[model samples]
Target chain A: MLDLHNLRLAENGVPHLDSITASFAPGTLTTILGRTGAGKTSLLRAIAGLAIPDAGEIRLDGADWRRLPPWKRPIAMVTQQFINYPHLPVLDNVAFPLVRRGEKWPAARDAARAMLDKVGLAAMVDRRPSQLSGGQQQRVAIARALVKKAPVLLLDEPFVNLDYKLREGLREELVEMLRTETGTTVLYASTEPREALQLGDRIMLMAEGRLLDAGDPRAIFERPATLEAAQVVNAPPINIVPLEIDTVARMGPFGTQELGALGRDLAPGRYRLGLRAGDIAPGGPHRARVILTEVSGSETVTHLDLAGLPLVMHEKSVVAHAPGSEIGISARLDRGFVFAANGALISQGASHG
Target chain B: MYRQKYLFLLPGLIALTAIILFPLIFTIRVSFSGWDVYNPGLSWAGVKNYVRLFEDTRYWSALSRLSLLAISTVLIQYVLGFALALMVWKDVHARRFFRVLFLVPMMTTPVIMSVIWRTIFHESLGPLNPLLDAIVLGGQPWLSSPGWAFAAVMIVEIWQWTPFMFLLLLAGLLSLPSEPYLAAKIDGAGPVRTFFSVTFPGLAAISVGALLIRLIEASKILDTVYVLTSGGPGEATETASYYIYIRGLRDFQIGYSAALSITYLVIMIVALTIIAKLMVRFLVKGQS
Candidate 1:
C-alpha cells in the first residue's frame, strides 16, 4: 500500500496540488484521470520520489517513504518519453539495473532476456533501441521497469503515443500481466477515459491540480460526484447546459416540471444540468438544431444548438443529421446529474416523467 | 537535374581543377625528373631519387622519428581528450570551466606555445631545469639532448592538438540522445559500466574522426619543432615538413626538396586513406 497524506506541492511559488490525501491499495491499479497540466504527472513523480512535496508524508506498506531516497524507495517510474539506451542492445538495456547491483554479466543477461521475453521482445534482443519502433521502445521501457521489480510502479501516460489497436492490446496485456505477475502497487495516469476505465480498479478524477472524486470505476462512471468527474468519465464528455429554475416551470416545453427538486437551493435562478451523451434521448421536450455530426464508424457524435446553447450527443447508430435540421431531445434523469452554477453537484437522483 | 546542379557548381570545379589538380600533376611530373637549381632543366632520372632517399640513413632516421612523434601525439591526445570529455559528460562540478579551459591550449598559436616552451625547457637558464634540479638528483637537457628534444617536440604537438579532440568529443557527447543514459541508469549500471557499454560506444564515431584529423595534423608538425629544436641535436626532431623546409631554404636543394615533398604528399594521402577507411568502418559498426 502507498499512502499520501495531506500532499501539498508547490512550484515556482505557486500551488500545484493542494492538500491531496489518497492511498493506493496493494495488488490494485489506481489511475489518476486529469486534463493536460492537471498535476497528474507531478503526483506520480512525487510518489516515485522524483519530485518531493513541500508538506506531505508518503508511506509504503506503513513505512515512511518520504525519508527514503529515490533509489531506496523500492519504486520504478516509466515516463511518457521512452528512455532506452540507444547504444546498448535491447537485452543489455533491460538488464542494466542488475549490473549496478554487482550481478555478473551472464546472470544480468539472463534476467534481462527473461524480462524481454515476458514483454514479447525476445526476438529483438540483439537489436539497438533506435532500430525498434516507437511502440516497441515503450514496451522495452516497460520491460526494464518490470525487471527492476520495484514494489511501486508509476506510469505516466504509457500508451498515449500508441495507435488505437496497439493501445487497447497493450492496456489489456498490461492489466492482466500486472494482476497475475506481482502484487505491485501500480499508479497509471492518463487523460483517456477508456484507458482509465479499462485499467483503473479505482479512478481518481482531477481537474486543475485538484482531486474532484475518487471511487470504483463503475461508481465514478455511473454516478459521478462533481461536474468535472462526470465530464472526465463520459466518452464524448458530459453535455452541460445552463437553465433558469423559474424558467423551467414557465417555459412551454418543460411546463411546470418539478425536475424532482434536483437544483432546489439554486435561489430560483441559474443552474447547470449535466447529462451523458448516451442519456440524451432523440424524442423529448427539448428541441435543438443539429450544428454538426461526426461519424466515427459504428458511432456518430452529433453537436446540437439547443435554445442557443451548444450541446453534444453520442448515438449508437449513424445519424445523418444536416447542420440546420431541427431535433427533439430529452434526458434520462436516472443517468443525469444536476449542479449549481458554481459547479457543485446538487443531486443525481432526479426522476423524469 | 544533374546538369543544372553541375552548372551551379561550375565556378568551384574550374578553380579546383586549375589550382589544385594542375599543380599536383606538375609536381608528380617534376618528382621523376633529374632537375637541379643550376640546370633548371629536366632529364628522366627514373628511380634514382627514390633510391637515394632509401640509402640516406639520415632521411630514414628522420622519417622513422616523425612517425614515432605522430603516433605518440595521436595516442596521448586521444586518451587525454577522451577522458576530459567523459568527465565533463558525467556532469562534474565546474564542467563549463573545465570545458573552456581544455580548449585554451588548442586556441593558442602553436608557434607562440613552442617559443614559450623553448624558454621553459632551456638547459641552463630555463625555469624547467632549475625545477627539475630542485626536485630530482640531476637536471637533464630538455631540447639540447637528442632524446629529450624529440620527447619535448612530441609533447608540444600533443598539447596543441588534444583540444581539437576534446571539442569534437564534447560535441558528440552533448548531441547524444538522453534516452540511452537514462536507460542505463534505470538498469542500475554503475558509472564505469555505463561509460563502456553506453557512453564509449556512442562516442566511437566522433573519436575515430577526431583521431584521424589529429593523425594528419601530427604528421605535419613543423612550427613548434622549428621554434623549439630548430631540427637540431643531430636532426632529432626533424619531421618530413621540417626536412623539406631545411632542404629547400637552408641547403638550397630546390629539386631534391620538391622531389621529397612529392614523396611525402603521396605517403600522407595513402596514410589518410587507410585511416579514413578504418574510421568509416568503426562509424558504421557503432551505428549498427
Candidate 2:
C-alpha cells in the first residue's frame, strides 16, 4: 500500500498541493481526475520522489519513502510526454531499468522483449525512440515502466498527448496490459470524465490543488460530494445555477410547476443547483437560446442561455442547434443535485429507477 | 533574368576567396619554387624542395613530436575540462562565478599567458618550484631539461584550452531535456550508471565536435613553445609550427618552409578527418 498524509507543497507562494491525503491499495487503479493546474501531476511526482512536499509523510509498505531518494524508491512513472532514452534502441530502453538493478544482459533483454511483445512493439525493438511515431514511442515508455514490475506505478496522463483515436486505442491497450500486473498499485491521472470512468477502479476528484473526493468511479459520478468535484468528473462541465427554495424550488428558467417531481419537497433556503449537462433535455416547456454548439463523435454538446442563466445541454447523436436560435429545453431536476451556497452538497436527487 | 540573385552572394564569395583562397594558392606556388634570402624571387625548382623535404629528419621528428603533443594535450584537456564542467554545471555555490573563473585562462592572449608561464616554470626563480619544495617535493630543472621542457609546453597548452572544452560541453548539458534524468532516477540508476547511460550518451555528438575543434587547434601549437622553451634543449619542445618558423623566418629558407607547411596541412587534414569519422561511428551511430 502507498499512503500519503497531509501532503503540502507551495512553490513561489502558489500552492501546488494543498493538504492532500490519500492512499492506494494494491491491485487497484485510481484515476486522479482533474483539469489542468489541478495538481494531478504534482501529486504523482511527489509519490515518485521527483517532487518533495513541504510537509508530509509518505509511507510505502510500512517504510518511510521520504527518507529514500528517487533512485532508492520502489516506483515507476510514465509521464504524459513520451520519454525514452534516445541513445538506446526500443529493446534497450525497456531493459535499462533491469540492467541498472544488476540484471544480466541476456536475461534483461529477454524480459524486455517479452514486455515489448505485450505492448505490440516487438517488431520495432532495434529502432531508436526517434525512429518511431508518437504513439509507438509512448508504448516504448509504457513498456519500460511495466518491465520493472515495480510495486507502485504512476502514469500522469500518459496517453493524453496522442490524437483522439490513438488515445482511446492506447488507453484500452494499457488497461489490458495493466490487468496482468495484479499486484501493482496504479495511479492514472486524466482530465476526461469518460477515460476516468472507463479505466479507474476508483476515481479521485481534484480542484485548485486539493483532492475533493475519492471513491468508486460510479458512485463519485452519481453523487459527487461537492460542486467542484461534479464539475471535474463531467465532460461538458456541470452547470451550477442559483436555486431559491421559497414555496417551491426556483432555479434558472424552470418555474416551480415546470420542475416536475424535483422541487416538490425541498427545505426552504437559498441553494446552488448542480445540473449535469445531460440533465437538460431539448424540446420542453421552457425556451433557451443556443449560444454555441459543438459536435464530437456521436454526441453534440450545446451551450445554452436560459433567461440570463448560462447552461449546457448534452444531446445523443448529431443534433445541429445553430447559435442564437431559440429551442425549448427542460431540466430533469430529479437527476440533479442541490447544494448550499458555499458549494457543499446538501442533497443529491434520487436515481430515476 | 534571375542573374541578379547571384549578386546577393557576391560579397561573401569575394571575401572567402580573398581571405582564404589567396593565401592558400600563393603558398602552393611558393612551395614549388626556389625562393630564399639569396634567390629573392620565385623560380621553378622542379620539385627540388619537396624531394629535399622527404629526407629532412628534423622536420619529420618535429611532425611526430607535434602529433604526440597535440593528441595527449587534447585528451587531457577533454578529461579535465569535462570534470570541471560537471562540477559547476549545476548545484554549486557561486556557480556563475566559477564558470567565468574557469574560462579566464582561455580569454587571455596565448602568447602573453605563455610569457607569464615561462617565468612560472623558471626553475630557481619561479614560484612553482618553491611551491613544490613546500609540498616536500624537491625542485628540479623545469626549462633547462629536454623532457621537462616538453612537459612544460603541454601543461601550458592544456591550461589554455581546457576552458573551450568546458564551454561546449556545458552548453550541451544545459540543452539536454530534463525528462530523461527524471526517468533515470525513477529507474533506480545510481550516479555512475546515470552518467554512463544518460549524460555521456546524450553529450556524445557535442563531445565529438569539441574534440575535433580542440584537436585542430592543438596541432598548431606555436605560441607556448616559442615563449616558454624557444625550441631549446636540443629541439625537444619543437612542434611542427615552431620548426617551420625556424626554417622559414629564422633560416630564411621560404621555399623549403612553404613545402613543409603544405605537407603539414595535408597530414593534419587527413588525420583529423579519419579521427572524426571514427568518433562519430563509435560515440554517435553506435548508440543510436
Candidate 3:
C-alpha cells in the first residue's frame, strides 16, 4: 500500500497541493480526476518523487519513501509528453530499466519484447522513437514503464496529447495490459470525468489544489459530496442555479417550483441546485434562448439563457440550435442535487425521499 | 531589370575572390616557379620543386612530427576539457565564476601566453624550475633538449586550446533536455552508468563538432612553437608550419615553400575528411 499524509506544496504563494491525504490499496487502480491546474499532476509527481512536497509523510509498504531517491524507490512513471530515449530503438528503450537493474542484456531484451508485444508494438521494436507516430511512441513509453514491474506505477495524463480516437483506443489497450500486473499500484491522472469513470476502480476528484472527494466512481458520480465535485464529474458542466425555499420552493427564472417528495424533508433557506446538462431535454415547459451550440463527435452541446440565468444542454445526437433562437427545454429537476449556499451538498435529488 | 539583383551581389563576390580565391590561385602558380634568392623573379621550373620536396627528408620528418603534435594535443585537450565541462555543468557553487575562469586561457593572446611560458621554462632563473627544486624534483633542460622542447610545446598548446573545447561542450550540456536524465535516474542507473548511457550519447554531435574545429585550429600550431621552441635543438620540435616558414621566409625559397604549403593543405584536407567520416560512423551512427 502507498500512503500520504498532509501533503502540502506551494509555489509563488499559490498552492499546488494542500493537505492532501490519500492512500491506495495494493492491486487497485485510482484515476486522479481534476481540471487543469487542479494539482492532479502535482499529486502524481509527488508520489513518483519527481516533485517533493513541502510538508508530507509518504509511506509505501511500511517503508519511509521520503528518505529514498526516485531511483532507489520501485516506481515507474510515464509523463504527459511521449518520453522515450531518442538514441535507442524501441526494444532497447524498453529494456533500459531492466539492464540498469543488473539484468543480463539478452534476458532484458526478451522481457522488453514481451512487454512491447502486449502494448501492440511488436513489429516496431527496431525503429527509433522519432520514427514512430505520436501514439506509437507513447506505447513505447508505456511499454518501458510497465516492463519495470515496479510496485508503484504513475502515469500523469499519459494519453492527453494524443487525438481523441487514439486516446480511447490506447486507454482500453492499457486497461487490458494492466490487468496482468495484479500487484502493482497504479495512479493514472486525467482531466476527463468519463475516462476516470470508465477506467478507475476508484475515483479521486480534485479542484484548485484540494482533493474534494474520493470513493467508488459510481458513488461519487451519483452523490458528489460538494457542489465543486458535482461540477468536476459533469463534462458539459452541471448548471448551478440559485434556489430559495421559504414558504415554497423557488428556482431559476420560473416563479415557483413543485417540491416533490425529493424536497419534502428539506429545510431549505438559500440553496444551490445542481442540474446535469444531459438531463435537460428539448421540448418542455420552460423556454430558453440559445446563446451558442457546439458539435463534438456525435453530440451537441448548446449554451442557453433561461430568462436571465445561463444553462448548458448536452444532447446525444448532433443538433444545431441557432444562436439567439428560442427553444423549449425541460429540466429533470427531480434528479438534481440541492446544496447549501456554502457549496456543500445538502441532498441528492433522487436520494432525498 | 532582374539583372540589377546580380549587381547587388558584386561587392561580396569581389571580396570572396580577392581574400580566398586569389591567394589560392597565386600559391598554385608560385609553386610551379623557382623564385628564390638565386632567382628573385618567377621563372618556370616544371615539377622541379615537387621532385625536390618528395626527397627532402627533413621536410617530410617535420610534416610527420606536426601530425603527431596536432593529433596528440587535441586529444588531450578533448579529454581534459570534457572533464572540466562536466565539473562545472551543474551542482557547483558559483558556477558562473568558474566558467569564466576556465575560459580565461582561451581568451588570452596565444603568442603572449607562449612568451610567458618560455620565461617560466627558463632553466635557472624561471619560477617553474625553482618550484620543481623545492619539491625535491631537480630541474632539467626545458627548451634545450629535443624531447623536453617537444613536451613543452604540447603543454603550451593543450593549455591554450582546452578552453575552446570546454566552452563548446558546456553549451551542449546546457542545451540538453532534462527529461532523459530524469528517465535514467528512475531506471536506477548509478552516476557512471547514467553518464555513459545518457550524458555521453546526448553530447555526441556537439563533441564531434568541437573536436573537428579544435583539430583544424591545432594543426596550425605556429604561435606557441614559434615563440617558445623556435624549432630548437637541431630541428627536434619543428612543425610543418615552422618548417614552411623557414623555407619560404628565412631561406627565401618562396617557390619550394609554396609547394610545401600546397602539399600540406591537401594532406590536411584528406586526413580531416577521413577522420570526420570515422567519427560520424562510430560516435553518432554507432551510438544509435
Candidate 4:
C-alpha cells in the first residue's frame, strides 16, 4: 500500500493541495478524477517522487519513501503527453530503462521486444516515435514503463491526446493490463469522470486541491460526501436548485407546492437539492409543462417547466412530449441529495448521511 | 509558351551577370596571367603563377598558422559556450538576465572589439600586465613576442565568438521536449546518462550549425590579427587572408595573390564539406 499522509503543496504562496491524505491499496487501481488545475497531476507527481510536498510523508509498503530518490524508487511514469526519445528507435526507447538498471544490452532488448508485443506494438520496433501516430507512441511509452517490472505505475492522462473514439479503447486496454498484472499498483488520473466510472477500482474526487471523497465507483456515485462531488462525476451535470422550505416547501417555478412524500418530514429551512436527470420522471400527479424534449437512441430526455423553474426528466424509448405541453412530473427523491447553503452534504438519498 | 516562361527569368539573369559573373570571370582570367597594378598589359603566364604559389614558404607557413588558430579557437568557444548554456538552462534566479549578459559579447561589432582588446594586450601600457604583476607573476611582453602575439590574437577571437555558440546552443537546449527528461528521471538514469543519451542526441544538429559558422568565419580571420599583432615579430600570426592582402596590395603581385587565393578557397570548401558530412553521417538516422 502507498500512503500519502497529509500532503500539502503550495506554488508561489498559493495553495494547490490542502492536506491531501489518502492511501492507495496494493494491486488495485486508484484513479483521481478532477477538472483542470485541481491538483490531480501534482498528486501523481508526489507519488512518483517528482514533486515533494511541503508538509507530508510518503510511505510505501510500510517503508519511508521520502529518503529514496525518484530513480531509486520502484515506480515508472507515463506522462499525459506521450514522450519518447526521438533519437532512438521504438525498440531502443523501450529497452532504455532496463539498460539504465544494469541489465545487459542484448537481454534488455529481448525483454523490451516481449513487452512491446504485449502492448501489440511489436511491428513498430524499428520505427522512431515521430513516425507513429499519437496512440501508437503512447503504446511505446507504456511498453517502456512496463518493461522495468516496477511494482508501481503512474499514468497521468495517458490518452488525452488520442481520438475520442480511441481513448475509450485504450483506457480499457490499460485497465485490463493493470488487472492482469497483479501486484502492480497503478495510480491513474484523469478529468473525465466516465473514465473513472469505467476503470477505477477506487474513485478519488478532487476540487480546489482537496480530496473531496474516495470510495468504490458505485458507492461514491450513490452517496458522494458533498454536493460538489456529485456534480463532478455526472455526465450532463447534476441539477442543483435552491429550495425555500416555508410552512409549505417552495420548489422550482411550481408555486408553493407541498413537499413530496420523501421531503415532507424535513424541517422548514433553506437547502439545495442535487439530482440527475434520471431522478425525475413523467406520468405523475405533480403537474408541469415541457420546455423542450430530446430523444436519443432508446431514451428520451424532457426538460420541464416546473412552475417557473426548470426540471429535466429521462423517460423510456417511446415517450414523447412536445414543447410547452403540460405533463405531470414525478420526483425520485430517494436518489437525490440535499446540501446546506454552504454546499456541505446534509442528507443522502432523502436521508441524513 | 516555353519562350514566355524563359522570358520571366531575363531580368534576374542580367543582374547576376553584372554583379557576380563579371567579377568572377575577371578574377579567374587574371589568376592564369601575369598582371600587376603597375602594368597595363596582361601576359599569359599559363601555370607559372600557380607553380610559384606552391613554392612560397610564407604561403605554407601562413596556412599552417591559420589552421592552428581555427582549430584551437573553435574548440575553446564551443566547449565554454556549451558549459555556460547548460548552467543557465535550468531554473536560475535571473535566467533571462544571464542569457542577455552572455550575448553582450556577440552583440558587439568584431572590429571594435578587436581594437578594444588591442589596448588591453599592449605590452607596457595595458592594465592586464600590471594586474598579472600584482598577482605575484611578473608581467611579460604580450604582443611583442611572436608566440605571445599569436596567442593574443587567438584570445580575442575566442572571446567574441564564444557567445555566438552560446546563444545557438541555449536555444537548442530550450527546444528539447520535456517528456523524455521526465521519463529518464523515472527510468533510474543518472544525470550523466541522461546527458549522453537524451541531451546530446537532441543537440547534435545545433552543434553542427555552431561549429560550421565558427570554423568558416575563423578561417578568414584578419581583424583581430591586424589590431593585436599585425603579423609582427617575424610573421608569427599571419593567416592566408592577411598574407594575400600583403601580396596583392603591398608587393603588387596581383596575379600570384589571386592564384593563391583561389587555391586556398578550394581547400577550405573541401575541408568544411568533409567535416559536415562526418558530423551528420549516423545522426540522420534518428536525430529528429
Off by over 4 Å in 4: A67-69, A243-250, A254-261, A264-268, A281-331, A339-353, B37-41, B282-288
Question: Candidate 3 clashing pairs?
Answer: none
Report DockQ per prediction, comma-separated.
Answer: 0.39, 0.71, 0.59, 0.52
Better of 1 and 3 by DockQ: 3
lDDT (tens digit, per residue) of candidate 2 on A1-353: 89999999889999999999998999999999999999999999899888899999999888998878899888889999999998899999999899888899789999999999999999999999999999999999999999999999999999889998999999999999999999999999999989999999999998878989999999888878888888898988999887888776667567654344556566688888888898899988989999999999899999999999899999988899989999999877878787777788767777721
Cα lDDT of model 4 by residue, B232-255, tens digit: 767989998899888887888888
Question: Lowest summed lDDT over 10 consecutive residues: which window, candidate 1 chain B?
Answer: B181-190
| Candidate 2 TM-score versus the reference | 0.93
TM-score against truth, every candidate:
0.82, 0.93, 0.91, 0.88
Q: What are the chain A TM-scores of the candidates, in order?
A: 0.87, 0.95, 0.96, 0.84
lDDT score for residue B142 of model 2: 85
* Candidate 1 Cα errors over 4 Å, as ranges: A59-73, A114-118, A243-256, A261-271, A281-297, A320-328, A340-346, A350-353, B1-22, B36-40, B75-109, B116-142, B145-155, B190-197, B252-288
Tens-digit lDDT string for candidate 1 (B52-127): 7767677667777788889888989988888888788766899999999999998998899899989888888888
The runs of at least 3 residues in candidate 3 whose Cα sits more than 4 Å from the true structure, single-residue gaps closed, are: A285-289, A324-326, A351-353, B1-22, B25-29, B41-48, B91-94, B123-141, B145-148
Q: Report the C-alpha lDDT of model 1 over A185-250, residue by residue, as the tens digit.
A: 889999988778878889998777788889898777767777878888777888875556664523
Q: Model 1, residue B72: displacement in angstroms?
A: 3.8
Candidate achieving higher TM-score, 1 or 3: 3
DockQ of 4: 0.52
Q: Which docking category, incorrect, acceptable, medium or high, applies to candidate 3?
A: medium
